[model samples]
Target: ANTVQVQVILDRSVPDRTALDIYSRPESGGDWTHHATAVLVSDGAEPGGARPSWPPRDADALDVDDVYEALTAAGLHYGPAFRGLRAAWRRGNELFAEVALPEDRHDEAGRFGIHPALLDAAVHLPAWAGLAEVPEGRNRLPFAWSGVRLHASGATHLRVHVVLGEAGSLSLQATDPSGTPVVSIDTLSARLVSSEQLKPAGRGVGDALFRVDWQPLELGPVNRESWAVLGDHGLAEALRGTGVSVSHYPDLTTLTGAVQAGEPTPDLIVLPITTHTGTEAGSGSQQAAQDPG
Candidate 1:
């Protein structure tokens, strides 16, 4: 874990006929290991080249609905903002996908070169092709992205081609509708994890969207004679907090008569009752019913 070595050896010197031989080893005292060797070849309009026929000739269409349903059942649900995959198909180890963000998300994609949601959707195509090497009760989550290159930006719609690899790893190339490269990853690996591990913590019901604004109730200009209240310290303090005049009445009958007569009658009345938790207060709605008028 402390060190890594990567050596590239050129197999050929010719400009168009160059080849690369890669050797890698860990710093933890390991022998030199040959990783990958590639021969650089000119890409033409052919299979396995830079440009290929759309959708591949023999790819089988996958059931997009079933893929989502299965993922949701595994607790891998994608919200509206992240659901970008439109359709997908597979041929052999190759996966093809069509992905498009909602029109409203175009501006965000423009600012951030192919929205991460869309990019993530593109990578998930292999999972839809049943390429995930996850064990039972387990799901695969993205672990790393290597050799990633963003060639262009401002693409809301994309076509993705993926080559599934061993152990839940894959390589993907994405392009805009015009066949301009949007992004490409030489290697994308996913880590196997239990569904429980992927489950997010429960969110508060009213974090920001639902909130209580505790504004002082506006009852009005003070009318000392117009306010009659009967309760313990709790009710007295509540009314006094609003800057309203509070007159304590000994009996409910006297309070009721004064309120119904409508002359020198208190416009607001309060009656306090003890709560189960030993608090000396009833809810605002309950006190509202105790108003004499």
Candidate 2:
């Protein structure tokens, strides 16, 4: 039957800890079988080490698109807002990355130290796990966690550090945009489970797992007579060929000032987004932008 039973074992000697086991039957008239056990502890969690430096100077910058493509090939799908892995780097046994929650997910950020989806992005960093050899085609689940501590809450963007453990585990630490500690995990253990365990006997485990929910965006055309762009000299020069008027501003602040002083305001504004692309300390950045209209 799909209905399962939960049993908890508590010790009077140690009231702060409890053991839990779940039992389910394979068929309507089958034997009751133990499915899972989890032990809950109310103590022993401690804050982790100091925050590491941001943008590791020696790590090789990884192609963010390549990283996501590899994960998708491995059957790990991420939705639009969930694809928050902006950039990544690797330096031997250590991995670092930049992650952010989309503006749409910011409303729910206060509900968690780090939104579950954002924390999940951190897990994908292990896709760069080249410091050691990994087994092939093994499906492992992280069922146990230890030394988890939350330093701060409501972070939208983070700089993450992941150190592969000597054994097959993960140690994670995350900080906010300004390098304030946000969360730390000492060790998260992943135990291998056989395919038989996943299928069980009667239950369709796939029904209980999560799937990518993709919402289609409704796009429409826009008509603008004037355009304003800042920071990118190349784009401004290109727009000069178009018959429409193009105004170039030195920066966003200057653009705002012209609009406030009764100067002509363009129908649409274009701004440049700076992104770090190299492992060097003072490397330059490339620009990306969406349709401003």
Candidate 3:
């Protein structure tokens, strides 16, 4: 989990000339298993690292569906369901594509941060675009990566771009709709294989579509369970660290009194955490504990 190194195989005769095998131990102290293997194609560059060769004379192409199938077949379950591909297109030797974000990826403040899983998924866009190549046949190999960056937050979409450079090197970039770059990869100095000519191990391709819902939490006194849940999940941490406070009122009568008295009640009010809980008037008791000031 700390670091990952992959192996790549290449064959000059095949159209798809790159393949990758990722190896990882089940646990920190557990045995190693061939986690996943994928095929890609490149004109004549190395697999991992930057500064391999340069702009390949020829371009390589690989099926998007095949790569997805290989990933799940290798026991790397993406999630509950795979959304369909968002978009795919080609420009010269370069390829571009997009994929949807998962639904369960929400942050504690009722907002979402860039999930690490999605970060891994974003890196695959370049390979899917045909900017790089994988090897052919049924082989489990490993690939190496250098730097990865998560620049944007609350991203609901992903985009990939790949450019072939001198000496068989490839430059890849991934971003979101706001044009915020998430990751950049330069792989030419590393070892790599091509697998564009091989038939996929399976016929079915995983879906790449997802539906997400964003709900804002009301900022008011909530029940013990709600307060604890929010705190444990991160809301409380954010409030405590930032010196923010939440106030709750028992009913509309008290709320109206405060409003008429020329006091701003609250920007938002969340109902009691429990269904059977009655209106407990004023600041309640938990609010004081949470915000002594």
Per-candidate clash tally? 1, 0, 48
Q: Which residue segments of model 3 deviate by more than 4 Å?
A: 1-67, 70-85, 106-113, 125-135, 138-142, 165-169, 188-293
Candidate 2: residue 182 Cα off by (Å): 1.3
TM-score of each: 0.51, 0.51, 0.35
Q: Rank the candidates by lDDT, best first.
A: 1, 2, 3
In the predicted model 1, the residue pairs found to clash are 226-266
lDDT of each: 0.71, 0.71, 0.47
Clashes of 1: 1
Off by over 4 Å in 1: 1-48, 131-133, 202-293
Model 3: lowest-lDDT 10 consecutive positions: 224-233
Q: Per-residue lDDT tens digits of candidate 3, residues 223-282?
A: 332222122334445544554454344544555565678755454443334324357664
| Residue 183 lDDT in candidate 3 | 59
Flag clash pairs in model 2: none
